[model samples]
Target: MSQVVDDSRGGAGPFSRFEFLVAGRYLRARRKDAFISVIAALTLTGIAIGVATLIVVMSVMNGFRDELLSKILGLNGHFSAYPLEERLTDYKETVGAIEGVPGVRFAVPFVEGQALASGLTESTGVSARGIEFASVQKLDLLYKSAVMGSWDGWDEGNGVAIGSRLANRLGVSAGDIVTLVNPNGTLTPFGRTPQIRSYPVSVVFNLGMVEFDSFYLYMSMQAAQDYFKAYDDVLVEGAEPPDVLATDEEIDAAYQRVYRANAIEIFIDDPDDIATMRTRIQSQVTRPMTMTDWQQRNETFFSALQVERVVMFTILSMIILVAAFNIISSLVMLVKDKGRDIAVLRTMGATRGSIMRIFSMTGTAIGVAGTLIGLGLGLLIAANAETLRAFISNTLGVTLFPPEVFFLSTLPSKVNAGEVGLVVALSLSLSFLATLYPAWRAAQYEPVEALRYE
Candidate 1:
């Protein structure tokens, strides 16, 4: 009895060696208490699954948001300036002034309109953008995305660039001809007549975004202006026709005199500094123009994505909460099954706090182990997310993340350390809290009554 008491006490301390020893014994349960062990295993598995799921889901959501933002903002500038009252006839000077502003990267002038494009296979509606060759070269995203053909003589020839998807849909490639029909065409005595024209596909670009790749086409600034007849009224009123035998410089000067841009698209160094950048640009341009930022244009779409992410996090968190409840139930059953052991330890000079500490250790060990395992599993899965996605997609003969619906061509994952830490903290906190009730119940066990039944 003296040795048993000495062993159980293991010196006068809060969490003595004896407490950990007994907790370990209870964790490695005997055959009679195998059912309790099973519950504990299930509880651990539950916590592990919950943490892993949360990490994977959060990473995917982050990746989705980042990819979409990059693709969208990469194609569209940070903001654009549209004329309020008059045609942007002097857009070149305006662009120069705007580009001189601090934090401004570059400004481009382009004409955008809708047209029906007819290919060999079928006809589809296209968003046509007429941009200068120099400006097109400055658009890093579009310029670098060219997969077929070259932009060598982009402005010299009557050719247009189309997205890779659009080219594929039209069953046309670079060097193939695609016809465009404009509903708002030249004005005639009868009425405004639709204009039909054809141009060879100069370049095929893959923006890696479904919407842009499937619908957008680009032509030269001169071609766009001529096709759209932009600023025709202003030109007809302001400038006279050049002489037939005019010099090259004289003719070029006359062209510039009449040329006008629909809007000036401004790219800034930092897109997040929209308010300050807008103020600076507006002040520098001194033109009566309405400014619009990327954030303003994409507010609704991004807002919906943010809301969906929050809701998904909340829903997935319930899995962890349910696992926490399982921990409580499993510990309660373990404490009940170990009633005789608790009584024996109490009679052998064990304090209530010692008994509580032992059980708390038992439950918390499960939590810590589960959390660590989940952290490893989640990181591994996230790191090889794309590879796994492809493997699974091939095996199942189904697309996991279709580019048409998701806007990205492949599965993407970005694991944020802060978010992973939060998940770990939440899991550990829930696990610790769950142990309190069962530990308290064990601490309250009356040695006399418990032993009398035994």
Candidate 2:
């Protein structure tokens, strides 16, 4: 150990080289003080572990949220437009006007409703949608990634596309026939009759999201109108039996009132400006319209993810707090162990502030060293998180995450430098604070009192 008093004899500056050297010497415990060294080591280790864990966890959460946004928003429209009641009769003209609106990327007529899908071997509930294939094909998930299907033969009159998960459940494939039962069928003299239509499966797509892939079906707008009985909302459910048998003129008039499109799905130029786009386009159309953004539809789910991240960070920070307490304990014991030496220093003209500075530096040195080590370890683990997972799965024969359930094929991490800086400052601040009580206690010693005990 470097001898501070011997090497820096009569140093002029207060709390200068002599203080730092003595502080360094005190940190390396003597043989009899091995137990104090262990506690000091534990304090450093605890702080290190806490800081590293927090960094890795925050990065993973950020990556997870980003991944979810990309996958979910890739398939769904940014905003939806619809009338208050009856379907838009002039939807084709409306869609054209919407496309011209500022910030609007693409607009298309959409028909969607519930139906009972019956396959060769199974039957399930589905949200069948009528779509303009050209506009739908522009989506990245539908064309570039996440989905596996061809646009070929998809609007070939009455042909429909099914999701991969749904196809697997129904035991149906391309070119196979699937029947859809529409409960909102035509009413008859006896009673309301359900309508059924059989269509060929044109393709199978995978949306990657389990909820979407397992429950959504798509077909041409014409097929949806025919199969779903989509028409003008001109019929009163409880009218007085129509007073007579409906004639061709009355039927033609009512059929004309039926609009082919129930809603308009729109893609905005910038998804982030959805609210601004909504305001800009709301006045363009005279019809009573309701507009909803993707965020509005899924606020609860995303909010929960954000809340979990905050809670995890708060909980992990407590670990560092516990480590600070350990530092306090270690420093207090060091002060007690060096009471006689402290008196010697005081007798040799050391001021109370100088004594305090020496102990403070000792405690702070432990903190700085631990924080650096922890920072390096944390970043290493975060960068190699996926590799670690793969290694565990392969070497230990334990599967970490199943892609189907988790909606992600690999672990992701995105460290924010600002957050890391904040953590370092916090850890160092806490370490400095922990030294105050012990350092102050050391400076309070009276040379005569300490020497009498010695």
Candidate 3:
């Protein structure tokens, strides 16, 4: 005890060096309270597992959200502007105006409408989108990801392209003819009847999304506008029939078509600065236009993913919280078991603060050790997430990540520094708090009472 007092007085630091030495010894040495050691080990394991799971889960969530965003943004423009009028006739000038905005990258006129697609075997409803092949190819995603046929021949005015899922449903392929029924047919003295026309399938595209794959159809700029009567020059619903009772095909063919745009598809430099860019774009334009940004377009989807990420983080953090409780239990037993030593140290000149620091250091050491180990393991696992997923799935002969279910071929992970810091900070804070009661209880021991009991 004189040696401890000498060591305490010998050090000029915040606490005696002797305390840290003893704390480490206590942590490593065999204790009569074997169950206490087991509780301590369990506590350490819990903290490690909690931190690891939180990092891995959050990373995967971030990756999944990012992948979805990439696919959506790649297929759809970052921002789209709809005209106040039914169709934007002077879309060439409008595209120039939108492109003049600083952040605006790619601005192109697009025509969108609905048509009933009829194949030889079956029929289905489809969203028809018209794109400028040359300008849109500069966007390049559609051109590059085309599953069958080149991004050519669409400009020939009579060609059409459908998604793979749609192709499968309709039992049609490229070069085959698929009839599109336009409900807004020539309104004659008789009620408006359906106008159907057959067009050769130009290509098949796979957007890697089930909804898009099954329902979207694409065509050339002139072809789509002409088919849907998007332009005013195209025949109005009901003017006159060529014959008193014209067949549907004859009625459909009797139309003069011109280019009319329903919307301008725009790509911006920074998606995060959509509002500033939107304001800038609106300022540049003279017409009353409505702009929908990427976030606004898919608000519900991203919101749901964000909510799920937060909920998962909260639930997984409880693993560490439970470990904190175990830390409290282990420390309490240590304090009780070390009561005689605490009293002897007090008589030998160790202060109450010194006793508290020693026990607190013990608990912190465990927490820090567990946290570091978990952090390392978590990052490693997250980095090689796809690899790990494949290995487990192959070994177990189970589908760990189904492409149809998750919308991805393999698992994804994105380890964020801020999230990792948050987990580490939370773990350390919990560990520190768990040490308080036991450390204080140990520090409060009276030398006389403790010695008498001993």
Candidate 4:
């Protein structure tokens, strides 16, 4: 039996350990065939490129998802409650009750409708949202997000907020009066009719998203109620009719009478909590079909992102798998070339297990080194993807992702540590697994036969 020495702690004679010598020699020895070194370098580079590309792509996807979610949640409420029927009375008391719910950040009553805005030169379809001017300011960042004019202007008679693109389409500016026509108009005894109203542009907002910027508008609740002819419908049973324009005392008494049945809308600040609240609210509200959260409203877009992330990760992982094959071939060649040395070592009291460990260690070294290098490269690229993209754009004289083609103008990356760790672990595991056959072959060599060939 060969006596194994514990040279790992410097307590043994010469050639006392198996793995350290084999790995060090294999890495440092000058090879007669430079192709081996070249192949190894290529394998390392391939792994680095693959890992870096995967990190950059995943990070960008995550960034896009985050940006889109922010835009949606910022502009829209976390959750919205409306009447299951067509109308809600006593909206003020409902708002107060919803505001008391835990995690509720703000609650407001809103009315919205679709209308067409027309100027002298052009006309466009737009969605008009009606909100209390003071409540709207507190509930949303709309005031801060506005590029021009004031949200308060909507309080002034017949004032409206238009999107930047809508403004451009209609060829109008703030303070310019545009005619709004409701195509879904009430039927008159005389003929089919359209309700036409003129509103002066109060504010113009640009959210940096073309979809919203082209379609959204804001006006006061009073204006929207009048426009939609819904004021009478939203008032209490004994309240003065909308056409009468109730005084403050009458409005307060009317609100108290109908507050119990009014449907309330709640907005929360945290998006992750939205799902839980949505489910709870859906179950809690008597009219379950009427409430909705922003996530439910934008499920399609969010689902697409999840699908994209999985597909991209699966596809990029193939690059590392291909590189693993190179490692297998390189180790196989090494095992064949060292057959004679392996036999001599066996004769000199080296166990089959030791020989196995030697080759296994060599392969492990290659994999570990490659994995570390790849991780560094990937993280570096993730940290500087924007700068690299900008530099490339400047050098190539072409934008890699133009805002017209891509929603975002610049490359965005966010490296998740867990994601990076998983990638490195996967790459290293593949490389180690690929070395198994070659290492096993080295351990199975017949000593006498291998020496005879030498």
Q: Largest lDDT belongs to which candidate?
A: 1
* Superposition TM-score, candidate 3 onto the true structure: 0.85
Q: Cα deviation of 449 in candidate 4 (Å)? A: 2.1
**lDDT value for model 4:** 0.74
* Steric collisions counted per model: 0, 2, 2, 0
Candidate order by lDDT, decreasing, is 1, 3, 2, 4
lDDT of 3 at 300: 93
Which of the two, 1 or 4, has more lDDT?
Answer: 1
Candidate 1 stretches greater than 4 Å from native: 1-14, 233-257
Candidate 4, residues 1-454, lDDT tens digits: the string is: 2443233223254333555776678766465746766777777777777777777788888777777777677767777787765456657755765666667787777777899889767988888878887766775556676787777656666788887877888988888888999966677897768989998888888776666777888888788877766555245656655346768776666653312223345778577787777665555444334677777888897898899899999999999888888888888888887888888878766667667777777776777787788788877887888899899999999888776555654566788878888888898888888888888999999899998856
Scored by TM-score, the top model is: 1
- With a 3 Å backbone cut-off (N, CA, C), the pairs that clash in candidate 3 are 187-237, 187-238
In candidate 1, the residue pairs with backbone N, CA or C atoms under 3 Å apart (3 or more residues apart, or in different chains) clash, namely none
Error of 1 at 109 (Å): 1.5
Per residue, candidate 2 scores C-alpha lDDT tens digits across 165-231 of 8888988988898899887788899887988889888778875667667888888887887777676
Local distance difference test, each candidate: 0.89, 0.82, 0.84, 0.74
